[model samples]
Target: MIRRNVLLLGLGAVLATTFPALALDRALTPEETQLIQQIGAHNSAIRTMAGRFLQVDSQGGRTEGTFFLERPNKVRFRYNPPSREEIISVGRGFYVINRKDQTQYAYPQDRIPLRNFLGDKIDLLTANIVDVTSSDAYMAVTISDDTPIGVVQVGLIFDKQTLDLAQWTLTEPSGAELTFSLYDIQKDVQIPKSYFYIDPTYKAVQPK
Candidate 1:
């Protein structure tokens, strides 16, 4: 769950609108809407990537890790050892595992927010593109959709210059804000499929 929780957060100071019941409480002009669609197209260009990430919580706690991502619903976030938490998406399931405890949690990929970006191809135009805002350094795209957890909103940030995903933030219905920032990113890298395989020995924790 740490992976899921961390995936919902953001970094440093930003010019942000107040969180609302609906992610898009305001309106997007014709130009702004088209720009967001264009950004979505740019995102889908990434076929594979590997990078390091810093997951910062609202409390200022930070965990660092290396991530391997292959398109079409496969990613592996291996946190530095002491953290003992890893998140992997294989096929249609999201698996969060604790190395030290040998405990694992699994959920249908659709149950989690932002799976659109995790797919083999990123497609924001097809989803509920609730809001799109940008700053000098980052373009923040807020995607809102109804999941089993009710309505969920995810803010995916891309570097304005490169149009690469920089970070993502989300405020859980419970008011937990989580953010993840990526660095040392390399694109079109080879990632082994074994990286996503769940250990059969790990104990599965059923969702409540």
Candidate 2:
């Protein structure tokens, strides 16, 4: 299951680096700033999201998958293409099911690196700005947490004109990165609550 998260992280890291920034001279106008604030605010309040994921690693490996995310802390990753596995988080607990082995692993969410990565109270823009720059096409902001073991840095790229989030990256402490690009991002989309529940039959494995 950690492999699954690592794969997703790799994808997000690559996508986050691909989107180049716009020209530096083009400062963000008041209107553009307002738009960015609104977008950030809206995203902060988003309760759930479903999207396609494409993750690439520094080693030239790639994985594609689908993800379901519920804010304030619930997420599920269904990886396809190279392998089959499911990772689901229910509140403070998480579960990983290995389809090939017909096994499951359970652990407290706080014990995993992903818990800090998927924090609900965080807003990519307002949370903290590590650095900000712009190019002819977009503006980029790098953000990171101050933790030791849980440290992760994210780069947010936004369209220069539209100020919409074009892409973002999640970089793990081990130097692994995952990039996530948003397409047709729908805010406040109704996601069924049942998606977060773990099946009762699967035996839970104690974390090592």
Candidate 3:
């Protein structure tokens, strides 16, 4: 059920995306801001990333998928069997397809929250950040913003030493959290452009 949210957010930490109605607005500390800059630079350096993902919804339901990502707003998720869902962004908008029902959902690219992760220069300093906490192992950034649907909150965890995104938890408007864990990430691999193509015939379902 929350698989949809994962696509909206799980695009990976070449990967992650969020909203929260009770927004947190404040000036980031100098040190906090600098760290974000470093993380953003690290993320942007990764031009392409492909990996396997494990997503667990608030209800603890699990779904598996393969994540493909290219910089500046192109990503795809090929869900495993029994899931029958494929989510892709073609530098324009996000397309969610249901193989079993032959249904497709579309959302404007700009309307998707936490899009900083998709840009050529992942800029967290400009994000509506709520808080940031870091440890020797990783740095966690919590961001919230408004979207076409509702408020969403996204927590991104980056491995401190390597600066690679380890995982992320996305909290939807309903306060349901979906956690996506990415592994076996291959960076800058040759992924053909056809991987992001969406057929013209699929019907579009408007976001709720």
Where does model 2 exceed 4 Å of error?
5-36, 102-122, 125-128, 146-150, 160-164, 184-188, 205-208
Screening candidate 1 with a backbone cut-off below 3 angstroms (N, C-alpha, C), the clashing residue pairs are 8-170, 8-178, 9-178, 9-179, 10-178, 10-179, 72-120
Q: Which ten residues in a row have the lowest lDDT in candidate 1?
A: 6-15
lDDT of 2 by residue, 1-208 (tens): 2344443321122234432332223455675566556656655666677777665555656666777877877888778745756877877666777667666776566544445336676454444444465578776665554333355566667776664556666666777666666564555567788777676776766434
**How high is each candidate's TM-score?**
0.85, 0.64, 0.87
Candidate 3: which stretches are off by over 4 Å?
A: 9-27
Ranking by TM-score: 3, 1, 2
Better structure of 2 and 3 per TM-score: 3
lDDT by residue (tens digit), candidate 3, 1-208: 5457545753222123334234445566797677778888988999999999998877889888898999989999898887777888887878887767677887777867647689888988787777677777778888776676576677888887787888888776676677789999999999998889886777767654
Candidate with top TM-score is 3
Ten contiguous residues minimizing lDDT sum, candidate 2:
6-15
* Better lDDT candidate (1, 3): 3
lDDT of 3: 0.76
Residue 101 alpha-carbon offset, candidate 2, angstroms: 3.0
1 or 2: which has the higher TM-score? 1
Tell me how far the alpha carbon of residue 117 in candidate 1 is from the true structure, in angstroms, after superposition.
0.3
Per-model C-alpha lDDT, please?
Answer: 0.70, 0.59, 0.76
